[model samples]
Target: MPCRTNEELQNLVEEAKREAPAGKVADYIPALEKANSSDLSAAIFYPDGTCYSAGDIKDQFTLQSISKVISLALALMDRGEEKVFSLVGQEPTGDPFNSIVKLESHSPNKPLNPMINAGALAVTHLIAGVDVTERLERLLCFIQDLTGNHSITYNKDIAESEFETAFLNRALCYFMKQHCVIDEDVEELMNLYTKQCAIEMNSLDLARMGCVLAMDGVDPLNGRQLIPFHIARICKTFMVTCGMYNASGEFAIKVGIPAKSGVSGGVMGAVPGRFGIGIYGPALDEKGNSIAGLKLLDIMSKKYSLSMF
Candidate 1:
């Protein structure tokens, strides 16, 4: 297989956009439902220092569940992996990302993995902070440092909307609390997780962020070590195993790269030693991933032999 030129990659995104309507934009939350379902965008930054973007690359969206990557990494850095894993299991849950049955089934009630809402909430609870404000500030700074973009901020409207309608998540956290998996104030834990999920970014910024992880915590552009190499490795491993919710196994087989997706239609992929890819297609599959974005990655993986497997 040959390396795809930027023009060819952009063309692929355009082609994938046609399938956007096969999925629907998430409407469970009022703010998320406001997204333009037809929109699509993609950006890629290679280790060789080339960057490319196409379509609505300027459009900003929430990180949604994708913020779990940062929260988990920060937890590892602040606390040890042993402690974090004790609270959140590393295995993928075959059930839905937000299922409560899996939590209750385990003796310790550990979340299946940090990518799901249950695990992510636990991970967020573990972030070292005096309060939610301090935790959010640290997490925000970590993201800004990773992307070298200080302008990123949470979408207040989206965060507030999630806060207003997080009854199921509240129930889930209380269950974890019962087992001592999450001891933080239930509302505070939910607020912090919701705010982090509301972090806004565009395709190019996300690609740059993914490039840091792809390069194993070092930014090729600046040669800065933003995260420890081992922690970054752990983060990528989870991305491969559970980043796409239950569809992660299929994604690993087809796209075969380390990637994470959010309900806001953003997919971040790190092709180790190659390039970091970012995609946004507001229409979502039932699993909450970007429909057109996954289609494009599958096509590119086969065409360019990008899969790690």
Candidate 2:
């Protein structure tokens, strides 16, 4: 792999920011409604250990669905593959991320995949500690190790906001419980899920986290093994199949990498053996993805030939 200097990568982010206004910011979350629709930022870590970043890369944002990947990875490490797979499927549902139709209609009522809230909630239940607190601590430890940053912590305001307006998620939890798919207390599991989503960090932290997945579950900069290779491969596969909510197919065609997006206007793309890319633009498209972030990845992937395909 050729070396990409910080300046060149920064230039890509600026060029991509020009497309920010092409979409709107996500407003359903209420707290996320205040974000500037045109905000754009990107951080990329190359194989040769260079970090390039530009725009609002330093702005703090919640992980939202991006936490799903981390939680699932932890669950895999704790329970291994068979148990996790039994609770969640790998197939992509073209349906909405929060769709309950399959849960009601399927025989066992398991979630379609780990990337969705349903699957992620299931994965979270399998986190395998005595309580939710321990599980969350484990998750935080994994994230801190992956990022090589110990200062990361959850944003209480964001967690409270989601907890206040998470009727849909609560209902989903009940549905899973009704089917006996979730064995733990619904309140505990949901609380853990919400907090995981609310853990705050900027693009630099996310890029470093992505570095773990990009390096096949090892931190490239420090060579720390945060997750098993199988777990990383599974998470990356899910990202490619279902990470962008309903836009996964289109994104795969355009960016051609295993990527995940969250309602908080964050996107993490893991380019195997090359780098982990993170983007933050509070503005979102209909699919709840950072609109400007997607455009930025499309632009960078094309320019640098970073597509996994």
Candidate 3:
């Protein structure tokens, strides 16, 4: 097959947006309720340092659940694999990302995986910091360093808004604490996690972030080993198995790439030694994934034979 040119990618993005129904935008958070339901964008960074983008590629969105990917890697760097896995299992829950069933009924009360809300909160609690602000700052610095965007920062409005309406998350953390799974105070850890979720970035930023993992933890732009190879491997493994929430298995079979999605309509994928991609389509499905973005990745993956399997 011929190489995918920029025009073809742009055409594909437009096609994907047309397929995006007027789906529901996340309104549970007052801040997220403001997203334009019609917005769609995508960007990719290849190992050669070229960036390809289409649609609303320059538009910004909060990291939302995608922040878990970076936070998980940092957690491994901070807490190490043994301590991290002891608190959160490395398996899919088959329930909603925020479901409380497995956390309650499962043995040891560990979260099913780090991609879920419960697991993310517990993982955030393990990052060492003097205070909530320090912990959040550390996360921000880590992402900025990897993305090479010094100006990257959080959307405090979203963080505060999500915090105010974070009833379910609060309940989950409280339960984990009671079960001896979480180490930090519930409110403090929630603040850290919320702030991390509120970190804003465009598709290019996400593509760059994914590119670091594409190189197995080394930032290609600078040649720095931002994360250990083993740590990046673990993060990518979870992304493949549980990153798309309940649709992960289907995505694996169809798209066959290591990817993570966030409720803010963002998807991040790393193509091992080849490329890193980011997609955004605010219209989400019942499963909370970007419906159009998923379709776009499936098409691109098939067209280029990007599937690992």
Candidate 4:
């Protein structure tokens, strides 16, 4: 079915937009600095192929950190849990997502979890392909299947910008490489990882992808098992434990859904057999999550009794 304009959701969006000014857009990437911090949008996709949306849902944004979930899923599918977890841990960290302290302090020199930058880089290195082109194509194809948007691709400018300034990520790669956690060349891995982060899509597309995870890897519209059920469960588990940077604990208490947020002001929520939600608001809080988007989910979770806890 088609996505219908939702006035109730629109009202929520307007209310959430009020929180935008209180947060700042992610300026570290430089390319993301150009976004309109005042803009907010949302879309909800149900299993029956029905969708509800509010605000400018068509606005596109980079996946940023949210791409971690997808890459983790793909890595699991390619290398299985044993090999993938050997390079990264399953625990959440109290530090920032991009922090390198854990890799230095932790035993065995592995990242804490796949949601963080260090762990995500390790997982991306595991995606099976002969080269960056093949690996990226495989990931893009998987994403295309998930969103059913064949035209979806990475934002070249955003990818270039991130690749150029990813000093911290490069450090993470080298650390992992030195420990033999990831054996690939750092530059090629960085190329793949940045493009993965730069994958672009709108809230509607994001919601649909979330819906697939909500359905436990099945594409609700076509009934295809896009990802293994157990692997999907693993991804959702991480979303609950570590998806929202360091604020995941508070998010669980308030929103209580399997969700991931990107610095581009995008939040993708999977309501597990109920519905999927997508949100975009470029203004980021100190923790790098979309401030307005978090407020929006908190409000919706309470008003609609959406907490899965």
Q: Itemize residue pairs with steric clashes in candidate 1.
A: none
Which residue pairs overlap in candidate 4's backbone? none
State every prediction's TM-score relative to the real structure: 0.97, 0.95, 0.97, 0.98
Which model is ahead, 2 or 4, in terms of lDDT? 4
lDDT tens digits, residues 1-309, model 3?
A: 213566777888888887677577888888988888888888888766788888877899998999998999998999899999999999887899999999879998989999999999988888878998788889989999988898999999999999988999999999999999986778887888888999999999998889889899998877889999999999889999999999999999999989999998999999888889988888898899998899899889888899989
| Model 4 per-residue lDDT at 290 | 97
Point to the candidate with the largest TM-score: 4
What's the lDDT for residue 163 in model 3? 90
Q: lDDT by residue for model 4 over 1-309, one digit each (tens)?
A: 223459878988999899999999999899999999999999999988888899998999999988999999999999999999999999999999999999999998999999999999999999999999999999999999999999999999999999999999999999999999999899999999999999999999999999999999999999999999999999999999999999999999999999999999999999998878899999999999999999999998988888888
The weakest ten consecutive residues by lDDT in model 1 span 1-10
Error of model 1, residue 47, in angstroms: 2.5
> How many residue pairs collide in each prediction?
0, 0, 0, 0
Give lDDT tens digits, candidate 1, residues 13-90.
888998898989988878999888889899888766788888878999999988889889999999999999989898
Off-target runs (Cα >4 Å) in candidate 3 are 1-4
lDDT score, candidate 3, position 191: 82
Error of 1 at 90 (Å): 1.1
lDDT of each: 0.90, 0.84, 0.89, 0.94
What does candidate 2's lDDT look like per residue over 143-217, in tens digits?
Answer: 888887799989887787888888888888999888877977788887888899999889988887887898899
Cα-based RMSD of the predictions, in order?
1.3, 1.5, 1.3, 1.6
